[model samples]
Target: MKAVVMRNQTLVVEQLTAPQPAHGQVLVKTLACGICGSDLHMYHHCENVLSGFRNANIPVAFDPRQGLVMGHEYCAEILDHGPDCDKKLKVGTRVCALPFVISPTRFEHIGFSTPYPGGYGEQMVLAEPMLVAVPGDLPAPIAALTEPLTVAVHAVNRAQLSGEEVPLVIGCGPIGLAVIAALKARGVGPVIAADFSPARRALAEKFGADQVVDPAVNSPYASWLQVAAPSDYDMRSPLALLGLGRQPRPCVVFECVGVPGMIQQMIQHAPPRSRLIVVGMCMQSDQIEPLMALPKELNVHFTFGYTAEEFVHTLHALADGSLDAAAMITGTVGLDGVADAFTQLARPEQHAKVMIVHD
Candidate 1:
């Protein structure tokens, strides 16, 4: 099989042995796959990512210095099942799965670990238990978004919002936009999104953000205060704490930007009692003042991947048209064009979520 392998921080097309399904696994043909932000991080800062994994005691099966086939957000067609498989879906059924293979010894992240090639290649093996059928006639490119959108779904789930807390999304990247979409799907109120990129702000509006903010001009928190904070509510006045006036509706801020100093900035600017959910993957060492969050009494929650139930819910929502994310697919390319697509994705104004379509 021909795959775009990451070798020495450069991607090159190479012929590699096609992976076979192990016991309780299924082999699937890659129909479409989305290039993830993590993929770019691995491409640029391989050693840092590896070091973090090592320090965390996360064992990776492959050596980054040699070669890695990186991709996880994908839509695929089932080709065959391995020994001990039930074969419930049948051959040629379209499917998507959580990108991991559960071995008897340990969990292998499908894209990052060794032995199991990810969706970047023509074919890859998936743990049968992790597979989810792509419902209805959803196109492969759109269905491929199940993985990334699930991240947003899990973040919203972790928030445990009262439906009254105004949502202020701090970044309008793919993850931020997905959060906005999930909030809207759940009928959560007038969503506010902030980003420095005008293009992203526009995309946020498209994804159902009631208001968009360009941090270069106006503060997103100010916009939230206008909608959520009562006119008489004053954090500075001691009298205001007695419930004498209408209290401000709490704001649930989603920090989708992983860059350094963002969490501190949120602590400084966010409304008191705000719930901060950090969804971004910051690779480098970051610093934050713990004392700043003390006064606000903010509830900071750091989120990672989704639960199996949340993943299924995300797929069904996308299939039923409850989650309209068609606008997120900004571009498509063949495997040969993946290298160039990565370059194009660096420009936020030009694209959001580029898909690699396999033929």
Candidate 2:
């Protein structure tokens, strides 16, 4: 199998032994996989991710010294089934999965498991129990988004949002765009979004943000001032500079920008008693003063991964055409180009949802 792997804190493309599925598993050929932000975190912060895995009680430590294949957002096809594997998916059946593989002894994440490999490889081995078969007509790249879409879906769920709440989202990356789309699909929008990229701002509107702000041009909080007039901004505060003082601000804010001060910024300007959902994956430790949020009594919510039900719900939504992910894909690359793809994405919004084609 040809795979893109992390070697010595760098990503390299190589040919590795294809994994064989054990009983209740199946061999799958990768059709398409999306390079996830988490993969980048794993690439640069290998030790931190290993610490997380250890805390999560993963029996097998991630031995970066041995190399690791990384990708969870993918679409695949069953090549062969192992003994006693469920035959519901015949060979060539197109599918997506929850990015988990359950071995007899323990459960492990697909992309992180060297033993099972991942969708970044030309071939992967997946647990049959986690597979979700999609219609043959669903595009591979779009199908590959099921994992991330579910992630956003679960984020929306965490909010327990009503169509009435005014939601402000920070960032226009794939997850940010997905959150916007999910908000629109659930009739929750005319939403506000902020990012540093003009390209991503345009993409955010296409995904259903009624308004978009470029923080690079000005603090995104500037635009929110009109809706949320806390007090006299004195022209210096981010909330006051945008000529604010309309009505009060929104009740909820989605912090999708994964940077050091995003959490603090969201906390600093959030309306009293508002809910702040932290959806971004910030890799490093930070010094955030709890006192900032304490006075406002803001509800801080942190989330990770989706339920199996949410996974299936996302697949069904994509397959049935309820979730139009055609706009989510920004680029395509083969295994050899994956490392570069990661580098490109690391820039301030160079692209969104770059798909890795196994073929």
Candidate 3:
């Protein structure tokens, strides 16, 4: 088998033995796998600090220590089933799978810390609990995106927003665009997407953002104020000088960029009782005024991964064509290009979703 691996903070693609499924697991032939933000983070040395944090760190659900495969967002075909594995999926059945697997006991022991193999290789051994059967008709590239789409789905679900109102999403990167697509799937109308990249804004519009804000050109501060206000601009406060009126905050806001400053800005411009879900991997400790968060009585939620049921829902959504995962996938490379893909992913203005093609 061919695999891309991280050894001593460096990445290389090399030939390796194919893995056999253990009890309760199945062997899968990787068809397509999506390069995620976290993969890039690990490639550029962010993983060492972030993945090792016992309390605050974002552990790569899958670790290279256990003979890791680097890709997480992927779809595969069941090739062989182990002795205890349920035989519901046939050899040719296409499936969307969760990159990480955790047992109930393990879940209780460590809330969100587990080491599971990822999908950036020619073959993988998938635990039954982490697998979701994908539709045969869906293209492999589209099927691969179910992983990230589910993240967006989970974020929206965390918001607890009603159908009566729309939502605001900060940052128009792949994750933010996924939020827009998922919001639309759940019948949420007119999602506002914010990003500094024009390319990203265009992608957001392609996905379904009713409005796009470019902080570099139009001044995000000014644009946010213009739409969110109506009252006294004393021209004294920073918010007032930006020309933003009183906040007519959206019912729900998804903070997908994870930038430290954006969180505080959202708090300032948020409506009286808006809910915000933090979805981006900011990679740093944020400093903000404590009172700003205390006064609004806002609900801030963060989710790790989609539940089993949500994973199935995400696969179904992709299969039925409710969400087009293909659009989110911007590039594909062979096993050898994994390192380069990671480098590109670190840049904010690069491709949307970069896939490592195994077939």
Candidate 4:
């Protein structure tokens, strides 16, 4: 199989052995895959790449330095099933499988310890019960967004924002924008999105963000707070009062920036009795003040990836057009173009979601 192989940070289109389904795995034909921010981290060594190795939960067995088929956000068609696979799945069926196949109970679980021989090639193997059937109406390119969209949905769900609580997402990357879209579909209260990128802010508007804030051009907390009603502006600090609209106060803050100090800033800016959801993967050496949690009476919710049910919800939202995954696709590249895509993604402020289309 032809794949975009990365060896010692050098990416080349090379032929590699296709992965076979293990005892409980399924072989899936790679349809479409989305390049995530984390992939760029590994590809570029992002000033703190070693942390990714330590963060991965699987046993230390594979060496990413030698080369790994790196890509996780994808939708595939089942081509074969392992001997122990369930009979529910059929060949040619479209499905969005969980890229993270980690289970403390399973003996051969492929934890994030090593890159999970992801969907960057023509075919790969995925664990059973991890792949969810995508609706027919959801195109493969759009369904490819299931994993990233699920990340956003999981963060919002963790933040505890419902119909009664307004959400304030503190970034406008693909994941942050997905949070805005998911919040609208779930009938959650008004949402405000913050980002410094003009392109992403515009995309946020398309995804139903009531208002967009460019933190560099405008003070996100200030601009958002002024429009917030007094109840929404309950941050208790006069300095935090900034928005000009009469919107509800933000009861939940989704800090998607994953920057070193952004979480602390959100906790300080957020109102009392609010929860902050950490969705972004930041550099490992970034220092944070842990004591603020007690003084501010803050609740921090750390969430990663998605559960089976949320992945299904993500697929449903995409199939029904509740979330525009197609629009999130800022660029698409072929196997040979993986290196350039990584370069562009490194400056994500310049691009949204970049898709890797298997030819």
Please tell me which predicted candidate would have the highest TM-score against the true structure.
1
lDDT of 3 at 103: 62
User: Poorest 10 consecutive residues of model 3 by lDDT?
Assistant: 107-116
Q: Which stretches of candidate 1 lie over 4 Å from their true place?
A: 59-61, 236-245
- TM-score per prediction, in order, is 0.97, 0.91, 0.86, 0.87
List all candidate RMSDs to the true structure.
1.5, 3.8, 4.2, 3.8
Model 1, residue 350: distance off in Å is 0.9
lDDT of 1: 0.89
Once model 3 is optimally superposed onto the true structure by TM-score, how far is the C-alpha of residue 295 displaced, in angstroms? 2.5
List model 4 lDDT by residue over 17-94, tens digit each. 777777778888888888888777666663246555447752334565656777788888899998888849799898
- Candidate 1 TM-score, true structure as reference: 0.97
- Model 4 RMSD to the real structure? 3.8
- Each model's backbone clash number: 0, 1, 4, 12
| Candidates by TM-score, descending order | 1, 2, 4, 3
Question: Per-residue lDDT for 223-274 in model 2, tens only?
Answer: 6655554455433444433434543544678888777888888878766667
Clashing pairs in 1: none
Off by over 4 Å in 4: 46-61, 102-116, 231-250, 290-293
- lDDT at position 285, candidate 1: 89
User: Which consecutive 10 residues in model 1 have the weakest lDDT in total?
Assistant: 235-244
